[model samples]
Target: MMNTDDVVIHVKEMLERASRPITEECCIYRVPLLIRQLNQEAYTPKIVSIGPYHHNSLHLQNMERHKVMYLKSFLERTNTSMESWIHYIASKEPLIRHCYSDALQFTPNKLVEIISVDSGFILELFWTSNYGTDDMYLSLPWFATTIFCDLLLLENQLPFFVLHDLFCLSVANFGNNDIPPFILLTFGYFQSLNESICLLIQCHHDLRSLTNFYLCGENKTTHGEEPMATNSSVNKWSEAGIKFAITKAMNTGKDVDILVRDGIMENLLGDSDAAAERTKRLCRNIVLSDFQF
Candidate 1:
């Protein structure tokens, strides 16, 4: 049997032999098998796939043509050629692939194709949702909400830089007297999903923090805050007519007092009661990992 240090050396050497890099830029991740097994539908995309992870899933295919249609509209409206964008994306091949935790099996060209169209669709979404549109997808409230939910999923994301670069690239094309920062536009996209929910983040002011709430979905547990009840316990409490309400202060981190939050309900769509249970269960049987922002 190998001794402790020998075993450690062996593991290190094996990692070196592997092609995967130390992904410091790695933020996007596939939902772990254990976590995905919790409630598959909550994490999986139903309406649209934004990134390479679920790029051509069969059920998600129907939205493909719509993405292309949105891309076409974006190009025509901006009169921006795809050639420059393609070159820009192609040059970032390694960095883009590194953003996801796993190695991307896609070819360089295929990866660029996926990012270009998907990012274009998202930028167009930010535009139409704010600027006004008669587009069929944006018009249907339910479908629009589903699309917004998918955008927030862990696996369904392009790197933030890719999105920021494209947003800046298309800014002048919009011919705006004043264009909001990309971070604000992103929050505005989330706000548009539910007119009832207002993301009053203007005063918070850090670009990084503003994007963290939605982009990464990293619910940072505070020093004293945590789950006092298990999944079954939370469900039982709700069943006993113990209604959970928003904290009067409405501050950060998990407020254990309110077991189910609108933030959770919005991301995991379902029947009201069912949504609450599912949201509470998200923390059950899961240990927080150090590998986060």
Candidate 2:
């Protein structure tokens, strides 16, 4: 008979081969085992190693402090009683295990990178003590969902629109596609206005003229009522490009409103000066002042 571990490995291999583009759900437990197998040499060190613990003491302490700050903010903002949040945590403990297991599939360094980015946003937004009971209290499960969604985007498995919809639903209802979805989510709650505005401006930079918003028929085509064209154009900015523009703007302390009014993003998004002016006029006239989503 085959060894049990061998059998399990074979089974996982079969399952993986059967599936096209393994999903988050598919790689949940299998990834950790694969990592262990792949890193047997590194992991087989002296069982009672002391260097990592001693050397990384300060780093670990900093991380713990950061987690505490994030938890504090989340509890305060959601007005969740400490006990209630703890209870919710207990309820969703299994899911957390799955997430960690999923994370372990990648190399430790890759895992750290993802966690750092995801947790940084959480800490930045939620690391505070002042929160109201009336505010929406997202549970750890919801937060995990956000993390997974972000991971999908980072991997390019899902598009921005998917994440945009999820954000809208979590924060507010998404209505018709009149105004941009980011704008709707931002304006829905006043407390989040600053963060929302930042995301909206980032999204505006990401937009490539809404290629899907096209008119149908040739001669007497209806304007603005047509579906998106089958083919869409993209004007994606490199990560370095985004960083440079944002850094320059932040250093100048310029208002984003002025940035748009002064036509800064036009060059950044690869629009000619003339195209930028015409597009701005089109946006002013065609965009609904009170469009919801």
Candidate 3:
């Protein structure tokens, strides 16, 4: 019904209105609806919420006091004041808000408070995991298993840069150049889960994305290898006279890679139920990503 010139002008207007500056790196994302629909629970946090998306959720409210306690302990240990942390996060409020897919409904003060507490809690948790003494919370069975699982959920994340910044600040306050990087602390905390999987965390935005990258083998090319194609099942490979043997030489704690040579398959599996479940979850998340795109 419209002439070509009229259509061209209309499209130009639409493009101008839609265009905006890409200032924020997408650090937080809503799990694609298609993916969430497939296995909603997989992407949902069960025991804790790390960032604004799930902040103030009723089921997660129980952990709020624990967050405050951790924050207090962190401040005491490092001799850094909370007001300074609040000011730093407040200055970056806009950029931090832009990290999330949805608009944050909290006022500036509330938003800054949320980010400060959450970030501090994460830093403190990692510190305690690596260096604290006889914290009863860490002794709880649920803390080692379920809490670790929640921390890795797609909906449960703080921007990695925020965590990195806070961790650096804390270490500096302690005047400790000997402190290890966040990645090492993270890997140490979760080494019991799956060591191979922890290696994926360095490059991805969040835990869920890291797991997806590992399952998809997206970084294999970095080592001059092609991305792994969907390989035949363990049973199917065995049928072809490929003898599978657990190898301690490559004990990474998860059979994430397969090396087949001379009718033998060296299976480097970790000795943890948590590692096996993590692999299964990675496979599920990959299928969800497939459905999403």
Candidate 4:
């Protein structure tokens, strides 16, 4: 409906805007509809929502009190003032917001508050789970199990750096040197899920990124000539004179290397419930990466 002059002016404005520097790339993403549709509950958080994406949902409101309780305990144990915590997280607001894929509509103060409370709760929860009294919340039947599973959900994650910053500050304040590394605590917490999948998380920024190490592996390249895609199961492969031998070392470093030496396929397999799911998802991702899904 506009004239040529108006269109030209609008195009020029758009081009100018596009030329500005992009401050952040999207890191968080919604689970693809295809994946979500397959298992609606798996991707959904049952107990808590950690970031702006799923913050303050009606069903998740019960956990809000728990978060506050944990925060209070954290403050008491660390003996650190709340004002200092706020200032530290407030300084990292822009960087933290950039971790999410979408623009957070909350005010800067609200965003800082969310990050501070959530990160504090998580750090405290981890510490308590490892070293607290036997009467803590984790002692509830199936409570720890459900919460650990919820934490691993994509939508129920806080940026790992936020957690690390708070943890370091707390440790510095309390002069406590006994806390284990975050990755080790996390792996220990969820070890029941997959003991065989050795997680070597280095320089990861979030739980989702850490989990990807298990699902997709470190390397993308196929080890040798790509196996021909055929309608063959492991049993069928065995019938075709292919022998399957389980590898002893199930390291993340060798996750994607499928070896075929002398008609033997040295495949990797895990023996836990979580490992079974990871194996299926890993194969699906590998095929999808090859443009075959």
Number of the top-ranking candidate, with lDDT as the measure: 1
Q: Estimate each model's TM-score.
A: 0.69, 0.27, 0.69, 0.70
Worst 10 residues of 1 by lDDT: 245-254
Question: What Cα-based lDDT does every candidate model obtain?
Answer: 0.68, 0.32, 0.65, 0.64
**Candidate 2: lDDT of 91?**
49
Among all candidates shown, the one with the greatest TM-score: 4
Worst 10 residues of 2 by lDDT: 46-55
Q: lDDT tens string, model 3, 1-293?
A: 75999889999999988734443466677787766776667778877788888887898899898888888888888888887788788888887777777767899889888888888787788787888646697559767577888887777887777777777776788777788988777666666555334245543365444444322222233544553234434444335554443222222233334433322333344443344444455455343222110
Q: Taking the tens digit of each residue's C-alpha lDDT, what string does model 4 give over 132-192?
A: 6454565685776677778888777777777777777767876667766776666655565
Candidate 4 local Cα displacement, residue 117, angstroms: 1.6
RMSD of each: 8.4, 16.3, 8.2, 7.6
List residue ranges in candidate 4 displaced over 4 A.
1-25, 134-137, 200-202, 215-231, 234-293
lDDT order, best first, reads 1, 3, 4, 2
Candidates 3 and 4, the one with greater lDDT? 3
Q: Is candidate 2 or candidate 4 better by lDDT?
A: 4
> Model 3, residue 44: displacement in angstroms?
1.2
Can you list the residue pairs that collide in candidate 2?
212-228
Question: What are the per-residue Cα lDDT tens digits for candidate 2 across 1-293?
Answer: 75899889999999887733334432122223444454333223211111111112342243345345554554443343545434433443333323322233444443333333323223223222122223233334455344323222211111223224333433332244553444343233223223312222333211111111221222332455663331121121122222112211221213233344444442333434444343333233233232211
lDDT of 1 by residue, 229-289 (tens): 3223434444555444322211222333244443422433434554445545565455543
